[model samples]
Target: MENEWKIDASESDVLIKSRRSLIDYMSGSKNNFKGHIAIQNNEVENASIEFSLKVNDKDSNSDLKLIDFFENDETPVIQFKSTSFQKVNKSINFLKGNLTIQNITKVVELDAEFIGYRDYNGTKNASFEIIGNINPKDFGLYYNSYSSHNGYAVGSDIKLIANLEFKNQ
Candidate 1:
C-alpha cells in the first residue's frame, strides 16, 4: 500500500545552529515550513521539504548582520528537495537531497531517524528527527575580512535540526 503524509507544521519544529567562536554559539528556530513524505510498503520512497527564514523576523532570532550576509532581499527562501533515501538500519536513514540557499544549489545528506507512528484522534501520525551540517562558505555566506581579522570568525559548519510530525493524508 502507498501512503502520503503531510507535515503538521503546528507540531513540527526546525532549528539552526552555528558557532561564533570556540566557546560562543548562536541558534535560531522557525515553526513555519511545508513538507511531504511518500511511503510504499512502510518505507519512505521519497520526500521533500522547504522553508524560509526572514533575517529581520524577531521571532526567528536572526542576527541583524545576517540581513546583508544572507542577501535576504534577493533570495528570501532556503529549500531542500530529497533525491533519495538510504536505509542504514531499521530506524536510521540518510536523506540525500539538493539544498538551495541564495539561489545556489548543492547536494547534501541529512541523518534521519524514524520515530515511528501513532494513532491520535482517529488519525495516523508519524514523527522524525533530521539533522545535517553545512558550511556557510559553500553558499557564499562568508563573513567580511574585518570580522575574520578580529577573531570573530563564524565557524564553517552550520547545523540544521528538525523535529517533524506528519499526518496521513
Candidate 2:
C-alpha cells in the first residue's frame, strides 16, 4: 500500500516509543510492540483478516501486555470473527485495549492482526515501533534499588522487529 500513510504517534500509541528505557535506570513508563503484514495479488482488506499475535519476553510484564491487547471484537464484525473485518466500529473497541508490557527483556513476538487491503505505501515492509507504560512489579529491580518495588523491571533492554512481504499473484 503506497498512500504516504504514517502511524501517527500517540500517548496511547500501540507500540513502544523508547529504547533508552530498555536499559536506562531513570526511564519511566515503557511500551513494546511488533507487527507484520503481506499483500498478494491486490491487497488484503483489514475487514477480512484474522490477525494472530505471538508475543514473548523474558520479563513477565511483556507477556501480560501482549495478552491485554489481544481482545475480541465486542460488536459483530463483517460476517465472521477475523481481524480482516472492514467494520470500523467493530474494531474501535478492541483496538483500544491493545495489550501492554512491563520490564520485558527477552525476545518475543508482539502481535499479528488480520486486515483488509489498505494501500500500505507500496510494499508490505516490516515496519514497527514501541511506546507505552511498563510496570515494575515484574522486574527484579526496584526504583533507587529500593526494596519496596523490587519486582519492577530489571536491566531494561528491549528490541523490536517488523516484517511484511509482497507476493506476485
TM-score leader: 1
Candidate lDDT (C-alpha), each = 0.68, 0.27
Q: Which pairs of residues clash in candidate 1, taking residues 3 or more apart in a chain or in different chains? A: none
lDDT (10s digit) by residue, model 1, range 85-132: 787766678888888877789999999887778877888888877899
Runs off by more than 4 Å, candidate 2: 1-21, 24-124, 138-169
**What's the lDDT for candidate 2?**
0.27
Error of 2 at 140 (Å): 9.4
Question: Residue 3 deviation, candidate 2, in Å?
Answer: 12
* Model 2 Cα lDDT, one tens digit per residue, 23-43: 221111222212222332333
TM for every model, in the order presented, reads 0.71, 0.23
